[model samples]
Target chain A: MKLYLGVAKDIVVKRTIDRRDQKRVLGNLYDYDVVIKYEIENFKDQPVILDLAESMRALRSEIGVNNQRDVEWELVADSTLTDKLDEKKSTADQAVFHVSLPLRGKDDKAVKQTHTIHLRIKNEW
Target chain B: MKLNGILTLTLALLATMPTAAKNVDLSTIPPRDTVQLTIYNSEDLTLVRETRTVTFKKGVNPLQFSWANTLIDPSSVDLRFKTHAGELELLDTTFPHDKPQMLYWAVRSEMDGDAELEVTYFTSGISWSADYVCISDPAEELMSFDGFVRITNNSGEDYADAQVRMVVGTINLVEKVRELAQRGLVSRDEAKDYERSRRKAGAFKADAKNELLSKLRADFAMAENAARQPKKIVKEGLSEYFIFSVEGTETMKNGWSKRMRLFQGHNVPFRIQYRYRPQEYGEQLVRMFLLRNDTVSRLGSTPLPDGVVRLYRDNGRDGLSFSIEQQIKYVPIGQEIELNLGRDPEVIHEWVSIRSWRNAFWFRRHGASVYYAPGKGHRIKINDAVVGWDEHQAWVERIRNYRDKPIDLQIRRSFDGHVVFRSNLEPSLNDYRSPQLTAQVEAGEKKELRYELVFHQGHNQKQTNVTLESVN
Candidate 1:
């Protein structure tokens, strides 16, 4: 484990669940049994920012992933109210701050990593 | 050297691997100006479409300004579509939020003059969603539970849409408090117990005041929001009205709307109108309480209890008597609670007659007039309000004190608290033993003032309600 501070690469998914609405309660709450889906990168060492809640897909098992070049993701948002997030793109508007995998002693230090952050608010009207 | 070569070869293979493809179809779908579609389970899959043109009544005429309630730009659809016998118009899914894709054509038949409108585009996932939110009974007066639904359209895919799901709730401000409470950050000793209990683990404070404060914060947060905005139940089928059936758990958010979160708070029932936004167009709620047992009291005195928002009033023996005659309950949830607007039967109010002589004089001086002096430099106050004004007349002979002085005053009062006095002059007697005149007021809350004036002429007296109500 090394204190590698490139972007401190973070993704904040802010979500606000307003239960005060009748339509929201019946349509959105009734479905999914209220279990929010999250992929979390659950790396035990990695944390995901809560921004685009719709992107989180709970892990059924584990998918084959390339260690060197892959996107790191997380679902970090409180379940009920709106989740606040630090601005994602530090470099630009689409700037998503994220840490890269092979985050360790990969001899391929010259290899660059690319990641995309999506924002989605799937709520009742 | 061989190991390095192997690593390079592996990297090249991974980069060249094929990616999954998303299908797109746009037949029989809603006409929309711009469409944005994204699925959580699968990615690299997105659809954006917009309406381009609309045909008119006849003559192959085309109309502009066509938009869809849900359809996105079709010409820009990314997924490929195959009709029963043919492929659809190829769409480039590039623009994310803008760009028109397809056109809605309303064409009249050249052979029969009949008309047909057609929308051509491509979209995947033959499914869409409809959401419903509900509230059973607000009149019942319980913190309500709202419900929501997510309708998944299976235009013709497979696998039951993996059990379509939708979550409903709000963001609450309780997070900070909760976090602080959990961290044992509350300063007050009482806050400790509350903090401890709320947390699953015991590393919290075990105090009541702190707990009460925390509870108050959560409760008030809910109430303030409830009062300002309608509780929103966001999901499918939100625009139209429907009977929302509560099929699962209920929750709420007590944080800043943008920061609200959900937690199990109340249970929901099926069939209620989900309020997406609270109604903000109403006056401050006025609650009324009536005095049931205590029927009549003094005249023009404390007739009803405090906060008794009376829409109507009737003349009583002493003054005015108000009561709830209609079905208007401010808070009607549990048991039948009764409150009276009339004076409490046990509350005693007393008023003295400064000049109403015993039999003969009292009868004769009825409605008699008084002349207050201008030298008084005072204004008569009824409920602390200045109503009438006069600069000259002092006394109507020994019977009345004329409107003379203008009293400049400021008053602060509560709803149940009222001060009714003549706005002009109070009869000033040089005699030291003037039989100290006074009136007693009791029992009534809520949060206000009344104005009146009195004229005394030895044993013949008359009182006129003057103005000038002031509040501070």
Candidate 2:
């Protein structure tokens, strides 16, 4: 039996905010907050264990178009839902991440930049 | 001594007869009257339907069906009454606890008589594949094509006098039939629950079952009708499935294979061309024989299945010379089939880089600053660092055809990274990254193709794709 999570329809990029003004700000580092909402469901008869950390590793974020700027992002340790799902049950959860865009120049503007986030679900046996 | 011999004979007869134990009367299954096999090549699955006459007593009659050493999925086993549907009822089917590969069905009969029962199940290890042979005449303009299908049976059971059909499309299977066949047997309650869930989810469609049975019946009728004629394959299209039903019955023994002719086309006309796709066929020119799977080519009766095609040429001296053997995918009606005969030594293709130079230099005032931005003009500074430039490259391609006949040739070249392609051959963009050139060379002629490319480097590069420009 396989679990169908409907990843395409269940995942949404909630919001992206420029968090450079937050406390503990660094001079050379640009920070942004990206929130995502997702739902995982087990529609089969067998129970499946979903490794949240492993799944979070597959999340990708890119800033700008054509010539893209390098950005690093990771799950914020907290705000992770359960790692396992029971049969015939669904869980709606939110994941928050901090994207660090390195400042290439003083005039570099990272705000309101066209960005894309891709999420893929990988099965772990 | 006569009385002793009679007693021994009676004992032997009693031992051979079916015995009733614990109110369950065990009866051996009778020989099949007619059997049909529908084999799907994409998957190791065959749907088998066979009929047999079984004598059932009034009340509950236990019939034993065993699939010992056979790759028959026990979960897919089904029993239906073909002759006395209204008079017989299947109470329940039970897999014996001690027996690993055996099952019993408790059938209730309204009246005691002989009734024909149909047993249908899915099995693995029986498969069919298709191949073709093409023989070209001395002129190479016309050819004869013949298709054949080879069916191999390794299912641990022999199917005698069975009609065979091959499906040319893929079907979705959640689980492999081989795995299920080796899964032993699940508990009756669990099996029922699984079946109920599957039905509720509509995973098992009733229409599909009906279609299968209808196709089998039609094939059986066609087989009977074509009994007197020479062996032929009748083609039918059922939704997305294309079936080739082999006429007449075949006795397929275990671990045996049989090849049957599918179709033959005589004097099918075709054309030949030479292609040079550097990205696909490496750096060599390949000869191709082209034909369409339509009536003009004498083959449009049905879609051609995927197969290996062997090409031979008639040497005009009462002998045939082998040319090439290529594998082709399934071709629908009216679709062209292109057979690649590999590199031809008679045609020589040479690609040479004539010259390369760098020009259009741009200088930057400050280090790591923009040197040449698009839509911006820059002046040369005395001590400025060189930060960008454009590189020019020229290439010459030559093709020499030594054949007696004129040859048609096509060449494709791919480039990347802000490239401007200028060629006198009037090349066109096959895609954003590749330029294509076509030419017709006369007999014993050599053609030269010249093209120049300019690649933008550093800040001069604005795009990452090739730009095609024609030059006289």
Candidate 3:
């Protein structure tokens, strides 16, 4: 059987504030965060090593649907899972990633998500 | 002209016949003599009026008008005798329960002859929009401006050989015309109530309509004489609405759009300036072209409607370069029009902080419940904690203009907290928190502006505002 990798429908996305530092500098860029909890299903008969490097690159355009002039998004490199997924998993695993966003002025405090992210899998080999 | 299957009229001579009779003597459908469409841009509404001549016998004549598959408001259908108003009487009107999208007008004629009848109704799915094209000379001192109006028709009816007029004002409506049109026909009781209310307001409408018709006739006469020339849009001001009547008749089919030139002007004088409004245009210096909407700019005959403006510049080599495309709001007469052309690479602006320091410390004594500034007739305690201080900072701004001509520049900077701004150049307070500076730079010249700011922090802050002061 060939390897099958598909995006799960139980993904969650939210807009939050960055809390990595105790003292946030005034006028600091990237003060907000877009947290995404995504899951991938693998149903291949044999165990397959899913390379996390190529998958991370494909997720850039999928998460940038809500980008605007004042509000932007960029994936955090260190927070992504660098491990591989095992085959024949029945929706038992998930991964989370953080995207840095920016905010300015008093009126930009209540930014809402206006679009949804739809992800699809592209099989290689 | 033919009615194009959009409107159908059937006349029944009901002499000595019962009201419930089904079969009657029916006359042939008559062609429309003239039609006029008055479209309002602020709403999805169009007032259509058509006139046709019909031969009526010296008895009761029932006329049926049907608008199937059209966006015509049934409640707004009205009929009036244009030629024999005194001789013909509209006895009653009806909307049959079996038939939809139609109405009947019973006319009792006293004489046998040809009488011209006018039918009017309101409709939806027709709208008009205005847009402009501006071409500037290489020197950027003059431009050619052309305005156009595009009319879109989607009302499921074709208007052939019709006079079109567009209105440029907003009117209040209790309900949308499209909603009423989509609701199909109303019941007999509701139709009677609507007709009664319309009759009560007929006097005011008649006066307004008469004024509009008189002006339109004068415009039409002028257009007829200039038939050999290019098409011209005749403009008139009526009450609060501005009307633009297009010359000649147009055949507007469904799902089609027609564009007509409204006006054109050449050699319209304009000026250019560079502005540095960080809050509005981010952190870059933007170039702008400014002009007035008055006679000096050759465009003050009427107010300009809100529309998109596409700007292009002559490259002085028999070619044009696209500059910018932007949307502008409605510009009244004598109002200035500012077009921002974004950032220019020829002009550069830089801001740098050169120095910073702190002084004027305020200390709060431990267990003393009092804070005092240094050297205020109080003995200083080494154990006292420093609670407040004043921070001083200096900044230098530079602007380089590389264009072949002189340029005027204005810069605005905003500061927060209790602050005092001191500068070598004269500065004015744009608001409570921002200071504005204006200067002129010659071509190939670089100018620098210096200013210092003092921020009072913690217990030393007296108020939260910026005060501008000139330094000798």
- Give the number of the best model, judged by DockQ: 3
Clashing pairs in 3: none
Kindly indicate the candidate among 2 and 3 with the higher lDDT: 3
Candidate 1 lDDT by residue in tens digits, B374-417: 23543322212111221111111111111132111112111111
> Which parts of model 2 are misplaced by more than 4 Å?
A1-125, B1-28, B187-231, B372-377
TM-score, candidate 2, is 0.70
Candidate 1: Cα lDDT at A3 = 78
Winner of 1 and 3 under TM-score: 3
Error of 3 at B206 (Å): 16
Candidate 3: tens digits of C-alpha lDDT, residues A58-118: 2323333222111112234443332222221211112232322223225433222222222
Q: What is the lDDT of residue B98 in candidate 3?
A: 55
For residues B332-384, write the lDDT of model 3, one tens digit per residue.
77999888999999998987554454567677787887986664665546566
Off by over 4 Å in 1: A1-125, B1-472
- Candidate 3 chain B: worst 10 consecutive residues by lDDT? B201-210
Q: What's the best-to-worst order under lDDT?
A: 3, 2, 1
The lowest-lDDT stretch of 10 consecutive residues in candidate 2 chain B is B4-13
Candidate 1 local lDDT, A1-125, one digit each (tens): 36755643333222232222122221111111122322323222333333332222221112211222112232234432223333422211112233433322234232223333322312111
